[model samples]
Target: MECPYWLTSSQVGVYGRAAPEDFTADYEHWKRVVAQSYLNGIGISWSSVRNVMDMRAVYGGFAAALRDLNVWVMNVVSIDSPDTLPIIYERGLFGIYHNWCESFNTYPRSYDLLHADHIFSKTKKKCNLVAVIAEADRILRPEGKLIVRDDVETLGQVENMLRSMHWEIRMTYSKEKEGLLCAQKTMWRPKEMEIIKSAIA
Candidate 1:
């Protein structure tokens, strides 16, 4: 699907908002943290990972890090901006996908690891956070890991939602208004069944 808005330039943007300065440093820091979390927190090795998806990939920094580890990576951006696409391409991120976070075009059980950085804060304004979480659950393989980084305001709510969905919280780090959480999908609940359960109760 095409992006809802056009981004004219690549000026340190994330979650449809422009950063005050270059986001390279932030991206690099998160990349290392995420990798370390997967290794130490989640207890998963790089060789065990086959495919990964970055749900709100801005300039593909995280994807690049995974690629360096020889893992197949897919980066999805919500916007269809002309300016950002070229920069993503320039970074040699050819596997980039475009779609809304709450709705994706990928097949079910398509990824081993899914990453979302500051996506909840952004999508909470436009779509149902539960829908986005459900979609993430739907696309991830059983036992797949979901790594999320978001502002502190929504951390508790996000954690509760994931727990309600049967995800196992692996690690969580929160300081002031920023946090990172990693959880693993341990079970599957079909969408139809979820609706039925909701309707019946």
Candidate 2:
């Protein structure tokens, strides 16, 4: 299969091209941080994490790192194109699932931990931010954690939306144009509240 133009092209956009070695190194640093987050129960502990989803796993680096720690991981990409299949396979990323961020194919409460790296900034330009958050809320189990990294411009909006949903912000760090946040899903709302929300929708 031909590589997708987005992956192969030199045109700059939300996701710019990077040297493979540099990308790998960056991912490695994040992997350690995420692993520590889990181990330290930053939002939720490793013991609480049974299944994880890398919402925008490029080259499956984060997923691979979680797997090395004996965690069950499913790597998801926005596009289902064959462009990344060879790379996925080469990296031994066996648990791959494809779906757009705004809508996923997984069942409700499917994952204990969901990680997104620079995904919101890219998707927000193309999809509804509310839809993306709702989908993430649906798939995450109650008390499940979400770890996200994105540029400063998009991070504020994303943080506000998650806060509005009553998700507990567990940790946050920012440096220049980049930011990282971890949040945990709380209890379900009252049925009447859901009904009112549905009505509003």
Candidate 3:
């Protein structure tokens, strides 16, 4: 079956002062973009819309802004534990989450079509993206598409990597979405112990 494009959000860390203006503008814009994307039959699905909704509900006014959208946006929270999966599945959704709190050697499996938002710009945090993309592909259903909105700037490398993994690059939008970079997750494989060890050695 063809994999669907899924939305993935990143974990919010204690970065610089919060930018409410940017956040609000982006949230409304994204709501429209997402709504339009889904309405156009682009195979788009939200990963953890609940989280975004909760965070932006009061501050970003998402409920009203996205009320007219027809996409199946589910209630979601950060997936810091495996237990979060059943909750999402109960909602009739196959969502994606990231686990970057580990070493490169301990990279986790990609949840097919994992949805992620706001990746780190620094190198240390940037390394986590591989795991994010890898896991998304790993757990994704056949021909699944992974969707992400991150702050990283290496689009070429990211696109190449996805293609190498057999994912078809459907479409990509730059910081136009308020520093929210979006990409599709296609065919991908979770790196095996043999492959990792071989590369390490």
lDDT of 2 by residue, 59-165 (tens): 66676666646577777766643344445566666545554543566754388898988778877776676677777887898899998889987878888988888
Which residue pairs in candidate 1 collide?
7-81, 152-177
Please identify model 2 stretches exceeding 4 Å from their true place. 1-27, 35-38, 41-43, 80-82, 95-102, 190-201
lDDT of 3 by residue, 1-201 (tens): 111123122322122223333334545665785566633545545442222212111122233345454433322233343233333443344343433433222133322333444432322253454554453444455554545554446454566667777777777766543333234544345475424332223
Clash count in backbone of candidate 3: 18
Query: What C-alpha lDDT, on a 0 to 100 scale, does residue 86 get in candidate 1?
Result: 54
Off by over 4 Å in 3: 1-27, 41-98, 101-113, 120-128, 175-194, 197-201
What does the lDDT read for residue 163 in candidate 1?
92
- For candidate 2, the TM-score is 0.76
Give the TM-score of each candidate: 0.76, 0.76, 0.46
Q: What's the true lDDT of residue 182 in model 2? A: 88
RMSD of 3: 10.5
lDDT of 2 at 191: 54
| lDDT value for model 3 | 0.41
